[model samples]
Target: MSDFTTTRRSFAKGIGGTITLAALGSTASAQTAETWTTAETPTGNTLYDVERTANGVYAVGAGGIVLHRTDTGWERVLDGGPTGNGNSLYGADVTDDGERLWFVGASGAIGEMDVVSQSVDDHSAPDDVTNNFNDVAVTGVAGSANAYVAGDSGKVYYSFDDGATGTWDYTTPGSGSAVNAVDFYDARSGHIVDGNKSVFATDDGGTYDKIGLADANANFYAVDSDGADDVWIAGGGGMIHHWDGAQWTPADTGDASLRDIEVAGDDGLAVGGGGVVYGRDSDGWNRQSTPTGQNLKGVVRGGVDVAVGAGGTVIER
Candidate 1:
């Protein structure tokens, strides 16, 4: 593990108790104050993940659908996903340069897309391991970035050579529990959360060490890492956990299960069941009224906050 010399700080100390927006009543007032609005989509398939790149925002989901947000509106860029098999895409991340988008999904499917060209390269089932990949993180340049894939088989499959079959390797991070999500801060450092309620950190890109949430009752669904010290994890029971280098602090926002979270500097957003959208600002995390009741599965913070969920729902702020 590389040495981290920066002073650690905890932002959760200022987090107040949970505030349920529904209980606030006055739909008239809430509607006017709402900042999130539903956007039209090309498909009714459920979207599992969304990502922001230099080119634009991309969303992937069931039926191998890849939707791109253009200057005009949302457009279907890839209808059959990366494999042309229509496998449901679950997670995605952009290369450090923001020119390539890598996505992983059901049936061990893995693909890389040239954001500028809209062309895809299939690198699925690396090393003949066909376990369903739940999430993926790519670091470095577009064509040769390291790819780390979270597997449902409790292992993390990785390729230092842009997911080339021969360069692929695997590591078991948790106790045979499904690895749900993975995110990288750099080429060789990142974090992964599993169904076992464990969060593991890897500094050298291979070996992993358990970091926090050892006794968490809810299953961790997603993780976003700014660095070893600054990480955000969202999971069931509306719980979001943060690692501030020295310790981990968890706060419960409400009853809805939080499926995904993204943090950039001091701002962030978390989305999950029942169209729940929680925004994190200088004050800490708080619930925000949304326009849909559909369960949200994925969210991304780019030029704007975009979230996608069940019934082909897409909302933005």
Candidate 2:
């Protein structure tokens, strides 16, 4: 889903149950990330993606709550959140300038959190034509600005500029598959993952083209660009696929149920349903052992690597 929208975004279905911190992966213990501490959970449910700002760490999860973590500790900015029955919150991302922060999940539920005032603007079902938002990205497009949220039913919601609210001209580029993840280097070019293991790319931001991956039926939750030329995908079945300007290649992280991935540059980190982290390099893939048993939902680079998920978890490496 969103690359982890397993971090998956638009595809977070309104399902019930406790997601074990480490149940859906390769069943192997990784190296130790002992220095990492688990951030307090806002609610006891699935948390997709997180963003680090100059003030604090803004994390959104089920039950419509926004959790803020400063240098001191974690606290809830808003108590039980948005007016919706959707309990699934999938993917989240902030602007490059950290001015706008957006969260998307099941039923097309999206919450844009203002970092300065900590105010929120919500878009849910009815406001959202399709209620399956899995992941999102904020890009500076020519005619568009703000950010864009992607989800199931092949729908993408565009923001006005940066993270401001705007008209959502939902468009299904080429295919009708559910988009688990979305990222854009610019307004014109971006990439998305459908339910299948395949990946789609758009050069004009209008039409999307299909690209083949090594694994089939592999559910991808997260994706990021290493410049516009290099792309990476993390998904279920321990599948880690990459594109190097030319073609997509498979890089085995040794776990099948990979949840999400993100890149600071060519360097990236992959997290799975298991408590594992895979760092890929020129030679091959290296594993990082995590502390808690919780499945790592999302990975992002600020000063360090931050992985977040269930059981009130947040890990930094």
lDDT of each: 0.80, 0.62
Write candidate 1's Cα lDDT for 58-167 as tens digits.
89999889999998889999977777988989888888778888888989889899988999999988888888889988778777899899999999999998887699
Leading candidate by TM-score: 1
What ranges in model 2 sit over 4 Å off? 1-34, 82-87, 125-130, 141-144, 159-166, 214-217
RMSD of 1: 5.7
List where candidate 1 sits over 4 angstroms from the true fold: 1-34
lDDT of residue 41 for candidate 2: 55
lDDT for model 1, please.
0.80
Q: What is the TM-score of each candidate against the true structure?
A: 0.89, 0.80
lDDT of model 2, residue 1: 17
Relative to the true structure, candidate 2 reaches a TM of 0.80
Q: Which candidate is the best by lDDT?
A: 1
Ten-residue region with minimum lDDT total, candidate 2 = 5-14
- What is candidate 2's lDDT per residue for 1-317, written digit by digit as tens? 12211121211111112211221223344344444556655467656677766455777776656677766766778644444564566777765556556677766576666677877676555343657777777653222354667868866666554443445556674367777888876555677777766566666555566655543546777777655446677788777766655455665566447877765444567777756777654444667666777887776655656777776577776
